[model samples]
Each structure stands twice: as structure tokens, then as C-alpha cells.
Target: MASPKLTWNIALAGECMAARPFSVHDDEESMRVINLLRGADLTYAHLEMNLAHSRELEYPNRGDWLGSFMMADPAVARDLKWAGIDIMSVAHNHSLDFGPAGMLATKKHLQEAGVEAAGTGLDLEEAREPAYLETRHGRVALISTTSGNKPNEWASLGKGGYKGRPGINPLRASFNYVLTKEAAEQMKAIARELDVLRQADGSTMGTGLKDNEFSFQMPGDQSTRGSNVFTAGDHFEIQSRCHPRDLAGNLRSIDEAKKMADLVIVAHHYNIADGKRREKVPTFVREFAHAAIDAGADIYVAHGWHWTLGIEIYKGKPIIYGTGNFFAQSEFIRRVPYDSYESWGHDMDRLPTLNPADHPLHPGLDTHNEAWWTSALMGLEMKDGQFVSMTLHPVEMGRTAREGTITRQTGQGDHALTDGRPLLATGETAERALGRIQRLSKNFGTEVTIENGVGVIRF
Candidate 1:
């Protein structure tokens, strides 16, 4: 029989934080102490406070962060659809930034605008369920999960909530920890109690637990708890180690999704922001992406770091570490500078050279504001079962053909040219961007090449 034709175009993965405009004066230096505190608090308290203030001061009428991006240019959303993105994963840390109300509004807007969203819902059950698409090829399922960094308060399926409800996937959590005393004892007692109940029922009690019983019990003491005690010989404790690439929950979701679809795609918001050359890829990325491929995922995409990171191909499947910013067009927010010692600090200015005269898109005095805009746009390509190619479209925040167009360019592909002025990143700018990708990928044993201002990662 001839092979089935794949109906879906592609699945784009990346992070789009709750949109809250900050003033141009909100620079890294201005918020250094706050950011340091934010790092110390893990809750992103300082960042949240700043976002809350921005919402209150800059967007009083908007209600939440969703309004700013929603009311901005429609062109970015239009371009995303044009780029063949049929589905999106909103399970990142920022999904609930504007609270559940903002998340729900985002979901509603995307759905109304014709895009499918996963990883959040009105309640836990809804959030756990995958978004099904009936494509020409076959049924496609998209599932998403976060690092649980966002407040659960904003996580729901109803109006003003994220995509899915909140619930722990036992299978995913099993790989990372052992069972606790309370959980293990609880499961043992439950099993004994169930046995007593079964005896009382006298309904042909079998020697072993039925598959249905196993399925039901597996999530509780039997699976997560049982495995924890049996495997680790200790009580369960959440792992403190940071692993960006670990895909435990993602893989489990994919396993369940595979039973209901022709193919499974996993999207996540992972943080691997050291941006330096190293001998090995971060432990989390390696474990998760590799495990996902082993579990039969067709694609694995992650985004959290604000810039494009790198890509890796494991067992023929494409695992994109970070796609940078897909539709991030929010300006007026304070742009935090990466520490001066960091390599990322070099490209703060839109100009390629140290001097301003050589770069036209150079924001000059407003370098921090333009830097974020200049670093967006990195797309993926896949054909059949293999990832074929990748492209980077340089985007700028400015007026488009239409009044609110956040215009992007495929390396000078279109748009009228200015008066013989040197374009941004002609030489030095391209080198720095590509260099960052290369340096970051060094730990992963991956080779990335920048051809005509586009960084390409090959397996």
C-alpha cells in the first residue's frame, strides 16, 4: 500500500511571555537589585512585581497582559499562520503571568483567530487532555506541559485560565524520584483495603490485578509511590537539580497521545541560559529530548531563553532547543542586559560595529530596547519523518505596510531600501549572533554554521 500523506504542516514551539509594556528607561542597571532578588526567590517575585506595575501603570484599561499584544499589530499573528504553524503549546512559565484571566483570554483569542492551543485548560482534566486535529494524513495530537514555575492560580480551562488543569502525571514523575514514606504506606494500605473489598464483593477475585485496575492504581501508590520506594529506597523529594532537556512529563504525555493519533509532538519551555562552550549538552536537554525520541516522538521543540539556542538530532528526530521569539513584539518593557561579562551582552546594540555610524537599524541611544527586537525569528523545517532544514527571519519592531505591522525580513528579501545607509549587523552583528549559537551548542557536541546570516545546526 502507498504511504499515507501527512496532512498537518508543522508545529512551532517557543515562549511568548505575558505581554506588559515597560518604559524605555527600565534597563538592566535600573533593575539589577530586583533581578538578583528575583533569582534568589525562584518565584520570580521581582519580575512579577515589575510586570504587575507595568500592567497597572502602562495598561490600566487593558485589564491584563493579554490586551497589549492582542490590541497590537495583527500582522504578527497573520505571519505565524502564513508560516504553516497549525498548533502552539502555551505551557511555558509565562502562561499565567497576567493571572488565569489573561491566560484564558489568550486561549480564547487564539481559538477565535483559528489557532489550536494545548498545555492548559479550565480544569485539571481539560488541561491533561490533548488537542486533537483531524488532518488529511491522520489524527494529530499536541500536548504541552510547563516546569510548574507559573502560579497554579492562573491554570484552568474556563474563562480566564491556561489550557489544561493541574495534575501530576505519575509516569513522568516516576523517572525522577523515589516514593515517600507517607505515599508508599498509603498505597500499601490501599492495596490491602482493596483486597478486603474484593473479598467482600466475592466477584471472581483473580491472582493478579487487571489491566484496568493497574491503570487506575498506577497513578497512585502503585506507580509513582511504588516505584519511588522500590527504586530509590527513600521518600519522594522533588529533584533540585536543573535539567533543561529532561522530557519525563513530555514523554509520558506523548506516550498517551500516541495511542490516539498518527504522530505526537512535544513542546516545552526549558531554561539552558549559560550560553557558553562546554564539553557536554546540558543534562536535562539530553535526557528529555533523547527520552522523547525513544518514546516515539516525531518532534521535540523548546523555548524559554529569549534568544535562539541550538538544535540536535537524536535518532533522526529533530529536537530544537530554542526557537527564540516567534511573535514577541512587545516593546516599552524594560530590557535587562545579560551580565556585561556574558557573551550575549556584546550584541546589545542593533549596529554590527562598536560605533553607531556603521549600523542603520542601530537603536543608538535606545540600544537595549532594539536588541530584543533584533534577536527574534528562527524557523524550523521538516519533511516526511526527517527534519530537512531551518531558517532565520530577521525581524524589526516598526510600522509595517499596515499601521501596526511588526515587520520581519528574510535577510533583505523585501521592503524598500533606505538611502545607501549601512544595514544593521552587516558583518559584526551576524558574527555575534552566529557565535552565540555556536558557543552555546559546544556543550551538546553539535556543529552550527551561519550561512548568509542564518544559523544551521546539522546532526
Candidate 2:
């Protein structure tokens, strides 16, 4: 007798916000979707929001600028468990919405649900640690990090009499804005009026700078190496790079994961688009994804902009730029902080019980936005430590009617709220959605063919 061929099936999705719990009564389409996930040897997705029972805002936090809170019901993790999610990456922008305690509670809930998560912990080292999921085929290792998180939300080291903070793993990056001469002058005046310039004593810059093109550099010991805020140019260009520590830390984790697991997946959350095209992958993301593959990642997935992006194949590996949403239940969330509403210039007293479309804070919840409702589940087949092919399963998110009934829809939906559960797309819907994916991925030099109802990538 010979050993098995060690063929493995893996499924991947992005940014699941399963605020509502599922039941046995779920529709057949939903069951089909779940079955596809359950069939995989290892299933992975980005757990977009925190999972907790309570809806209160506690702890000394500082992300009021986000203007919204994303907390899914912890019981929803049961739905993910039922859907057969093996591993998840939970280090995105909303990881600390309810503070570090909320993040920790989410980790506890996921653990209880038997879903291992990466990219968050009690300290920086732990946050950067790799999470493993053991399977009969092979052990799958996951390392997740986010490039867009609040400064205060970053996990810190407690050394030399400093106190360590609990938070998510971060792939931090900074933005430098360029502007016209007139706008630059205006920014300078505003900065001067606001006293943003650092004095001889070396103070901090203004946090409330309205102008993105204002150039302000904080003093350094031997060099002025702080982020230069802005420059005046006719046509502005922005430069972005993964932070050195974050890049090195995650790469180290990938190396370690290679030693421990048969397969490694790196999930990063970042949004870098080409102009108005939200699906365009940025240069930094491309660089980082390729580096991860070189460092030992079998698959590299990026998400967080809430739209499906392109895919690139580098060194016989797949780099999924963005998988859109596995589930987006933000519209169905019951409670949000009062400050969240206020940040959107809404009167707290006149709180409108309107739908997310009517609400300023959650315009994406509007079902009319087809991109928000369309996404795909990727299935990758690997055998004998070699790449095989990928299958794209186009899924249509469930939408809620004005009468509060759930309806399966593809493309645009009625003004009704989105239920945010994924279902397999069929008929012309599958063709259309998968066609869109083909178009999105073509620019990255990855081609796909629609076979039956799913998109196939033959190596």
C-alpha cells in the first residue's frame, strides 16, 4: 500500500459580517453554499467585524473618526461554524471597534466556535503569531494583518518600564498628499493658525489637519525621518509602502509557518485603488503579496475595501487581491454608539429609524449598489505539494424586502435591506457575476473560463 496522493481542497472568502444567526431552515441555495465550504479540506475567510454580545462602547478608545461601529452578534459565529469555516483572519479596521476587550471577546467566541483566528492578541508578538488548522490532508497555517488601523489600536510592546497594549496585528502605512500651490499655501496658513509646526522642544503635529497636502515633519534624533505630510505639485501622486516592522514581522511569521504547516495563507487588509476603479490593486500590495509568496505563502489574499479586485499568479501561486464580502450584515446591526451618529453630523435626538440607504453612516448597505451584493468563493486544488487550479464560485448575497422577507438576488436589489448571507448564483446570474470576475482579473494577467456555472482557472 502507498501513501495517499495528499490532494487538498481549499476555499477562501473575504470580510464576513454575519450579524444574523442562521438556522436549519436556511434555504437550499444557502445550504449549497455551505456545502461547498464544508467540502473543502480547509476553508478560510476574513472575519471583518468583532463578535460580541453587548453593544456598549467602553474603554478609553480613539477611533471616533470611523463614524461607525461594526459589531456582529457572537451567536453568528455558530453560523460560520455550521458553514464549516476552519480558519479566519480577524485583524482589520473594525477589529477594535468596541475596544480591545471587544476584540478579545471576539477571539474567545471564535475559539469556542472551533474557528482558529490570526492577526490579533494581547501583545505585538502574539498578534503577529501564526494560527494553524490541522486537517487530515495537511496542516494549514494562517497569518493575517491589516494596513488600515487606528494608531491607538496597534498592539504595543511593554518594555523598559512601558505598558504593553492589547490589539490586532497591524501592517501600518502612511499617506502623503500632494496639492496645487494655492491649496498648499492655504494648508500652510491653516497649519500655522492651528500651531501644527513642532517647536524646538519637539512636540507632536496636529491630528485635525483638514488639508491632506499639508507637509509637516516631526523632528528626529539624527534625521527628520517622520512622514512628510504634503507637497505642492500640478498632478498629485501618493506613495505607499508597508511599514518596515509590520512587513518584517509578518514575513517572519510566514517563514515560521512554512516550518510548521504544509500550506500557508497570508491575509492582509488594505485598500489601494486605481483612481475611481476600486478594484485596482496597488503597487505596494502587489509587492507585498509577491514577497509573501516568496517567503513561503502558498496563497496570498487581500481584502477590506469591500469590493472584488483583481488576481495575480506569481511563481505558481495565486494572489487574490480582494474577495469582496462573504457576508456584509452591517445594515442589520441593531445598535451603534451615539458618537458614531454624531460623527456623521446627525442629531442624536432625531435618530432616524430609516434603513441603511437612508442613513448617512451606511450608504453601502443600499441594495442598489450591485458590487456590494456580489462576491465569489474561491476553491483552490493542490496536489503533491504543487499547484493545480482554482474554481470561482459566484455567490449572490441575500437581500431583505421592504416587507422584511428575504429574497435571493443577483446584481442590483430592491431598496430593501440586505440580509447578507451568501448563496450560490445560478442561471444567467452566475454567468454575469463570474464574467465580471473574469474582467476584473484579466488586467492582472490571470484568465478564467466559465464552465457550467463556476469560473475555472486551469494551470
Candidate 3:
């Protein structure tokens, strides 16, 4: 008997966060600090808010953060299983928001549920490993990475590199005021004394001070005596930038997996998509995607921006700028009072100029409004390794709690609260969603058409 032939169906890419409840109290200060330290405070805040709202609606309502979205909504995992999605990349910034414990839990859940997750691990060795999947047609490798100055610091699965920490290159910040002429001489004397001590230690103790230890002993003196002496006017920027070396290391792991697979898919959590205010794409995105393609990746998918952006073809490979939100189970609907216009559909507007009277459901239209947003996403796609096709599928984020009952959309638009089931766009709303995509694509030099509530963009 001969071995069976193999076939791989699909690889879906996007972002997922640990679910947190919404905070009614203002927490901008704490959030800002977290954002500065971590690259994704807004996402964490969004999770916080959504979870809070969900709890209130669920009753017995003692508030507690759900830790990870995957845990909160098993339906999402179920959907992926049903869709035949075998692997996922978890390299986004928010992957570390709930901390290492949460990340491990999420990864554990996915594995037990039979889904493969890559881009993070329990140690540097694990973080640098790739997730491999095998099918009848061929094998597939999924790899992920986060962007910014401190990717390792935010690494949830491994030992993090930070100043005064046990990881890799640590980030440290300092300031040194210029010394007076006399002060400089005094500092030089102290340095001479330290050198004498170092020599004594080398001879007697048989151990010399490490370069970094020596520098830390007299930072001010060193700064004053250096070719570029520090002054009050001098400013130093000391962000712990993610070294390409680290990225390359992770890529190497993926490459190893690639050797065992027929296709390689790389997913990153970064802002590849420019917002409405910017016309041109970012240089980093273009450069990085091209680098990955040149390094032998078949597809490069990135998401961080809340909306979909552009698609570019590099060296005959497809790079999707952003996929927007996919199955985000938001809790916005629960925050607003049911009697308000938001709950009744008071905000639906087909044209730029929205009229409350013309669009009666505008006030109550939350997820319905997002349906149009999701439809607009279909306008981004890649075909035959070129920037050729784009399409959007309007997906409601959550599963219905009960059958045959109408529910409202959450702020994240992840689920319908009534039965906790995912909702699909329908009727006039679905039609308009298709139309919106058709119209938006015009600006990008593409033509979009919709049939049966599906938007297809022709290049």
C-alpha cells in the first residue's frame, strides 16, 4: 500500500487578547504608565472595559477579569476548529498583558483543545520555537513576532531582558550633568582610585571588575570624561529597542520548521495599516515584510490598527497590512442603557452625512454599524502571491446564549449577548456593508462588488 497524499486548507491570521472587564472609574494615569512600559495599553484597557460590561450583564456580578479571551469564549476556539484552522501565531503586544501565567494558560487551553500556538514559550528556547502542523497535502509552519523597542521585555513565555534583569540586553536610563573644570579633575582622581582598586582586586582576589560593573561604579565620571561629554543641554534616549538579532534568531527557528513543511506563514502584531489620516504606508512595515519574503516566507500578515489598510506585493509574495478585528467579543452593548438610542438602532447612515430620521436604527445600531466596518475589511486581500484580491466577511464576535432571541452587539463586537452566539449581517444592513466596501476600494485603485452579502475586490 502507498502513503496518502497531503493537502493543507487555510491559515487565518489576526489578534487576540486576554478578556478584561471595562473599568467604570477613570484609570488613564495607570493605563498611560502601562502603555509606556508595554506597547499596548489601549488594547488592555479595551479588554478591561469589555469584561466589566459582560460581568454586569451576567449577574451574581462579582467582577473578575477572565484572564484570556480564549478562555472566555470557547465558541471562538470551536469556530476555528470547525473551520479547520490548525495553527495560530500569538506574537501580539497584548499577549503579555495578563502576564506570563495568563499566556501559559491560554497556550495550554489551545493545546488541550487541539490548536497549535506559536511565537511565545516558557524560556528563550521555547519563545524561539515554531509551531508545526501536518496535513495530507503538506506541512505548515506558523511563526509570529511583536514590534517596537522592547519585544523581549514583553515576551510572556520566556525570561525577559531588562536592565538589572537576568535576560539579554537590558534597557537602562540615566542623566549626567556637565561638571565644572575643577569637578572634572576631582572625578578623574576618583576614577584613578577606582582603577587602583581594580588592579588590587585583579592581583589579590584574582577577579577583575566586569566592564559593565566598572561603568556602573562611576557613570557620571565616565560620562564627563568621554569624547562626547555630558552637559545639561545633552539628552539621551535609551529605549530598549528590539534587536534584529533577536528577530533573526526567532526567524531561524521558523526556518527550521519551514524545512519540515511545504508552506511557511509568518504573522506579526504590528501597525502595518496606516490610519485614515495617513496616505502613505510606514517604511518599517514595507521593509520588514520584504525582508521576511526575501527570507522565504509565503505570506506575511500583520494586525494592530483597528481598521484594515493596504496590501502590497513584495518579490512575488503577499503582505497583508492589517486584517482589522476578527471575532472580537466586545462588551460595549452592555454598558449603554437598553432604552437609549444606541440600543434601538439610531445611528445607521448610508452616506457620509447621516440623518437620524432617515436611518431610524442609527441610535440602536452598534454591531450593525460594525457590520459595515467588517464588510469594508474584505477589500484587503492577496492573490497568487501578488496584491490581487480582497474580500470581507462580516462576522459577529460572540455565540448566542439562546436560540431565536435577538441580542445587541458588544463594544468589541465579539458576541451577541442574548444567546452569546455570533451574529451575521443581514437585510439592508448587509447590503450596505457590501456597498461600503465597493466604495472604499475605489480610493485604492480597485473595484469591489458584493453578492449574497459577500464583498469581492477585483484588481
For lDDT, the strongest prediction is 2
Cα lDDT tens digits for candidate 1, 309-365 = 666767777776765542343332233212211232346454233331222221222
Please give each candidate's TM-score: 0.52, 0.84, 0.52
Local distance difference test values of all predictions, in order? 0.43, 0.76, 0.43
lDDT of 3 at 287: 56
Q: Which run of 10 residues does model 1 get worst, by summed lDDT?
A: 41-50
Scored by lDDT, model 1 comes in at 0.43
Instruction: Return whichever of 2 and 3 wins on TM-score.
Output: 2
Candidate 2 residue pairs in backbone clash: none
Model 2, 1-459: lDDT tens digits are 533456788899777977778756467856888888899889998988788777434652543554447777788887788888989998988788788888898888999999999989999988999998888877889999887676778998899987788988888775566677787777778767766542233335334334334455433322343455676777667656677777888899999998888888999987444334455677677778988999989899999778777777888888898888878777666666666676666766776753334366654653455556677899998776556899999887763222223474323534445567888766655666687779988997889998888899877
What value does the lDDT take at residue 231 in candidate 1? 18
Candidate ranking under lDDT, highest first, comes to 2, 1, 3
Q: Give the better candidate number (1 or 2) by lDDT.
A: 2
